[model samples]
Target chain A: MAAYVQDAIMLLGDSLTQGGWEAHGFAQRLSYVYARKLDVINRGLGGYQTDWAIPVFEQIFAKEHEQHHVPKVRLLTIWYGANDASPAPSPQHVPRDRYKTNLSHLIHMVTSPASAWYSPDTRIILITPPPVNTYQWDGRVFDATKSYAEAVKEVGLKENIPVADVWTEIWEAAGKDEKSCERFLSDGLHLNAAGYEIIFNTLIKIIGENYPELHYDKLQNVFVPWSEVNVADPRPSLVKRPAMIGLAQL
Target chain B: MAAYVQDAIMLLGDSLTQGGWEAHGFAQRLSYVYARKLDVINRGLGGYQTDWAIPVFEQIFAKEHEQHHVPKVRLLTIWYGANDASPAPSPQHVPRDRYKTNLSHLIHMVTSPASAWYSPDTRIILITPPPVNTYQWDGRVFDATKSYAEAVKEVGLKENIPVADVWTEIWEAAGKDEKSCERFLSDGLHLNAAGYEIIFNTLIKIIGENYPELHYDKLQNVFVPWSEVNVADPRPSLVKRPAMIGLAQL
Candidate 1:
C-alpha cells in the first residue's frame, strides 16, 4: 500500500546499490519484492562521490528521456556521501559546504528547469550513509560516515525532503555487535549482502510508513528463502535453468 | 633507452591487446614518447568483456592489499574487448558494465592489487574502446559495437583510460569524407589508441601528441594530454594534485 508503488522508483546511490548482494541491498530486494510493478532502475556507481553522481544523474536523465520519453522523475532515493568524505582518485568529494552545494544542486536538477523534460511530481528520498565501523581504522580521525550523515541530514531538512537516518541505525547496530564488524560491511566502507538487506528493509519500512500506495510486500515473507534464490553466475547462459533467478521470480 | 623505463607502466588490453594495436596504443606511445625511467605493468583484463572488469579485478585486488604498501602502479592502461556486445541493460552497455563491474572493481578501490601499492610506480590510464561502427544493420543485431563499437566501450574506454580509441577514429577517419566504413577496424573490431590516434591525431594532432604532464611527472616525458584524458570531471579543483606534480614543478 505504498503511494509511490505505481511510480518508477530510481535508486541513486554509490557502491551499495552497485554491489547487488545475495538477498539484501535495497535496490535488488525492492525490485525482487515488488516485481513487475515498479520499474526500478539501479543507477548506482561504486566509488562515486556527489560530484560524480551529478554528471551521472544528468546522463541517466538524458538517456531515460531519449529512450522512454518520460521527462519527470517520479521517485528518487539517493544514498551517497561516503566517497565524498575522502580524497579519492576521482576528486568527486566535496567538503561540507561543497557537499551541501552539490546536494542542493541535485535537488534542483530533479525539481527545477534543468529537469523540465521530466515529471514535476518527483519525490526525493535522501538516505544518510550507514556508519563506518571504527574496528578497522585506516588512520583518519573523523568518522567519515558520521560526517557525511550529518551533511545529508542538513540537506534533507533544508530541502524539506524525507530523510532516513541510516547512519545512526548502523552505528548502533555495529556498536551492539563489536565482535563481528564484518557482518555489516564487507569492506570498512561498503556493505555486504547482509548489510544491504538491513538497508533494504529499513527503506521498505520508511516507504511503507510514508507512502502507503507503494504496496511493498515483505519479500522475505512472500519469496523463497535466500538459499533457494538461485544466485548462479549472473552471466547469461544457454542452459534452460542456469540456477539464476530473475527479478520477476521474486 | 633504459630497459623499459624504471617507472611502472601498465599495458592494459582486452582480448584485442591479446590481438595488438602495435603502432597505435599506449604500448607504441610509451615506446616513442615516455622517458626510459619507468616500468610498465600490462594488466590487461583480457576476454574480460565489459561488466566483468571491476568485480573480477579492481575490487578483489583492493581488498587484498594495504593502501600505502601496495605497489606503485604508476602507469596503468587498459584496453578491453569487442566482447561486451550484448543489448542495453543486458550486461553489455559500458555504463552498466562500469557500474556493475569495471568502475567499482578498478576505479573506486584505492588499494586495488592492480594498482602499484606504495611502490611509487603507480599510475592509471584508460584506453578508448575500439570502434564497431560498421555492421549489417538488419535490425537483428544485439550489439552494434560488437561488430562496429557501441558495445561497452564508450565510458571507461573513453573517460577513465589515458589512451583511448572510442571507435570514432576509424569510424570517420578511414574513408576520407567517403565513409569507407570498414577499413580501420578488422572484422569491425579492435584497435589500440595508436589506431585511434591515427584518426584522433589526424583530427587534432597538436593537442593529441604534445602536452605537459601537469599531474604526475616523476616519470617525465610520459605526457598524456589533459584534453585526451577523459575523467567524469577533470577540473583542476576537483582532484587533489598528485605530489609528484608539485615536486616536478619545484
Candidate 2:
C-alpha cells in the first residue's frame, strides 16, 4: 500500500452534474481515467441555485481544513446555472445579476487566503451551462440560461480562473442541426451520455493543455503495485506507506 | 444537505471487481441504483491473491471501526482466487489449502465480535472466481481456479453468507455456446462488460430477494427536496440537520 490516499477532483454543481450517476457519464469516466490516482467526489446538488451552494461550500472547506495526512482536493469544478436560470415562475430561479456575483464570491472564497481551506495549490475551473433547446425546455428558462452562461464566462475572465466553456463546445459539436443538439440533452436540460462525453473530453483536453500535472497519467496512484511490493514484507507497503495493491493493478 | 451521509456497499476483490470502472460495470450500476441511497466503495485490488489481501482488510477495518457518525458499511464482498489460482512458478500462486483458510480468516475478522469494526448488522458476501478458459489463462491456473470457486461456495455454506456464485452462473448462462462464454471474460482472468453485467444483475437480484430494505427506492435520500425547503430558512435543512438539497433532485 502507499503511504497516502489520493487527492480528488471535486464536481460541484447542480442537476447537470447530478446526471453524472450514469456509468458512461463524465464522473465515472474521469474516475476511470484516474482509477488509482484520484477519487472523484460528486457534490452535484440538482435544483439548487448559487445562494444555497455558498453555505455548502463553506461546510466542505471547513471539514477539509481540519483534515491532515489525507487526500487533498487538487481540482474543484464549479458548474451551475441550470436551476438558477429558471424563469421567474419557477421556484429555482436566481436572477442573473445575483448569479454573476455569487460565482465571483464562490471563486474568491476558495482562492483567497482568507478562506477556510485556503491553499493556492488547487486548480479551480468554472463551467458554463450549455444552451437548452427551446423545443424541449422552457423557452423563458432557455433564453435566461444563455445570459447566465455568458455571466459565468465574465466571472472566469474577472477572476482569472480557467473556465471550461462547455456551452460553446457542445453547440459547435452539434453544428447547425437542431436535432443534433437535442442528442446532447436528454430532456433539453440535463446532459445525456453524449453530452457528458463532450464535457469529459473537454475537461481532459483543457487539463492536458493547461494543468498537465493533474492529468491522469501524471498523478500518483496511491499503492505500490503488487509486482513492486517486497513480497516478504507486504505489510509495510500499505497505502499509508505506499505498497497497497490497487484492484486494477494499473 | 443530508443529516447523515449515505451508507456504502463495499466491493472487495481482485481484477474482476476492478473492471467496475465502466458505466455498466457492477460498481457503476450499483452506484446508480443506489444513487442517493448509498455510496458504492470499490476496494478491488487487482492482481491480488487471498493471501495478499489479509493485511489490506485489516487496515480498512481498523479505520472504519473508529469513524463515529460516519456512513456505515452495510455490505462487504470478498472476491478472489484469479491471481491465487496462478500455476506454480507464477508469483501470484497460492495453494488451495492456504486460500481456503485465508478466506475463512478474513470473514471471521469481519463478523466475529472479537474483531474490530464488528457490526452484526452488516452482511458479508463471498464471490467465487469464475472458470477461466485455458486458451486465455494459464492452463494450470485455469484448472486450479475451478477448485477455488468450489472452495468459495464451501466457505459461503459454512459461514451462512450469501454468495454470488459467479463461476457457475457464467457457464450456465453460456449454455452450449463457447462464444457466449467468451463474451463474459474479456481476458482469461478478468471479466468483460458482459461478465460484469452478469455480476451486477445477479447481485441486484440477490439483494432484491434477500435484503429488500437495501433497495434503492426504499432507502431514504439524504436531506429534503428543494420544494420542501423553507425558502426563508434553508440552513435548517443542511445534511447534518436533515435539510440537505440534492443536486439530482432525486
Candidate 3:
C-alpha cells in the first residue's frame, strides 16, 4: 500500500537497551524519534553476554520466524559484550576468538537464505560494548572490556557490517572528566539513563545518515538534557566521610 | 556481623515479575514487607520465556559470586512460560515435550552443583503461567493458554519444585464472565496493574506459609479497588441494534 516498505528495527542487547532508568533509555528514545516509520522491538536482557544472546536469538527470534509471519526486520542492532568482560561462572567471556565466532554466527543467522523471515536487504549494525568505568572494577578484570570491544570491531570489519564504536566515544568523553565516570554507570557496569542517552544520540546520527527516509524527526528526543545529566564523583577526596580520630581524641 | 546469612530473594521472570501493572506488582510489595531482612532483586523482562531466562540466570546471579562476596541466594522464584504459548509462525505452539525440556533445564541449572554460589538450602518456586481469559481473545490462540499453563504444572511436578497454580485460580474467577476477562488483561496476554494484584495475593499466600521468617506482614497493602477488578455482566438481552429493512419495503 505504500511506496517503500516499513522499517522494523530489532534491538538486541543487555540491560542498556532494557530501559532501566525511568524507561528513557536509547531503545525507547529511538522508538519515539522514529515512531511513525519505524517499528522497534527491544529484545534486551539486563544481564546477558554474547553467548547468552546467541541462544536468545535462536529461542526467541528464530522461534518467532518459524511460527508466525514476522514482519521483515530491516535493521538489526547487536549491542552486547559488557557482561562478558565480568568475572563470571558461565565462562562465556568475550575472548577474541569466541567473540569473532559469535559475531559471525549472528550475522549469518540474519543474512542467511535459510532464514525465511530475514532478507538480504536487512542491514546489520554491530555496536561495540561501552567502556567500563573504573569504579566498576572492585578488583575484577573490568579493564578487559576494551579487549572485548576491540574483538567486536574486528568481527564487524571482517563481516563487512557497519560498526558503531560506542566504546571510543564514551572513553573519549570520560577522559576529559575522570571524576564523574562512575555516575554514568548505574551499577558500575550498566549505563544509567544518562549513559543510554549518549548511545541513543550516537545511534540516531548513524542511522539518520544511512536511512534518511526513516524521518527520525518524528520521534521524541530522549537525550536533550545536557545540563541536568549528573556525573558521579569518583574521587575519595570528594566523599564527605565522618572525621577520623584526631589529636582531640587523645 | 549478623547471626545468619542475609537472605536474598531473587524474582526472575517475564512482565508479570517486572510489575507491568501499576502497584509495583508482587516483588516490590514483598520487598517492602520483608524490608531489611530480605534483599529482593527484581530481574524481570517483559515478553521473556523460560528459554530466555536461563541465560539471564548465568549473568546476574551465577557470574558475580567472587566479586560481590555475596555467599548465596536464599530463595528464587521463577515465573515464565506465557510468551512461549502465544501465536507464532512454524511452531505456533510450544510443543509440550520441548516445553518440558526447557523447564527441566532451568530446574537442573538452579539445583545443580554448578550453582555453587547459591546455598544448598536455596528454595526454588515454579509458578504456573496465568490463564488467558476467553473474552480477552483477539481472535488469536487465546484458548491455547490453558495448555501452556498445564505444561508448566507438569514441569513443576516432574522437577519436584513448589508450584503455584495461578492459572486455575484466575480462570475459575473469570468463568462465564467474558467482559470481566477482557477488563483484566491489558492485551489478551499481559496483565494490567489490576491483574497483577490477583497474582501477588496468590504468591504471598504460598510464600508466607513457607518462609514465615521473611515477614510479609509489614508490607503495605496496595490493593486494587473493587471497581477496578473485573466482574462479568450477565444480562445480554438489554442490548439494542439497528433495524434491518427488507428489500421489498425499499
Best by lDDT: 2
Per-candidate count of clashing residue pairs (backbone under 3 Å)? 68, 29, 12
Worst lDDT 10-window in candidate 3 chain A: A241-250
* TM-score to true structure, per model: 0.42, 0.88, 0.42
As for TM-score, the candidate ahead, 1 or 2, is 2
lDDT of 1 by residue, B1-250 (tens): 0001123344544545433323344333332233222322333433445445543343213233342222234445545545545345544334434433563355444334454322223344444454453462222132444342332344445434343444555545655321254455544455534454563343223224432341223333222222333465444322222223434321
Write the residue-wise lDDT of candidate 1 on A1-250 in tens digits.
0101122567676766555423345654554454323434555656566766665565445332442322124467888877677644435456767887888888877667555324454577888877665565352224665788898999998988778787766767767553365678876667776677678777777777776555444222221222232234533321112011332321
Candidate lDDT values, in order: 0.48, 0.72, 0.56
Query: Any runs in candidate 2 off by more than 4 Å, and if so which?
Result: A1-4, A60-65, A117-121, A176-179, A238-250, B1-4, B117-121, B138-142, B176-179, B240-250
- DockQ agreement of candidate 3 with the native complex: 0.02
Docking class for candidate 2: acceptable
DockQ of each: 0.02, 0.34, 0.02
User: How are the candidates ranked when ordered by TM-score, highest leading?
Assistant: 2, 3, 1
Q: Model 3 Cα displacement at B30 (Å)? A: 20
Model 2: residue B85 alpha-carbon error in angstroms: 1.5
**Per-residue accuracy of model 3 over B13-111 as CA lDDT, tens digit each:** 766666531333565455434432343555565655554555445544543233233324556777876766766642223455776787787677667
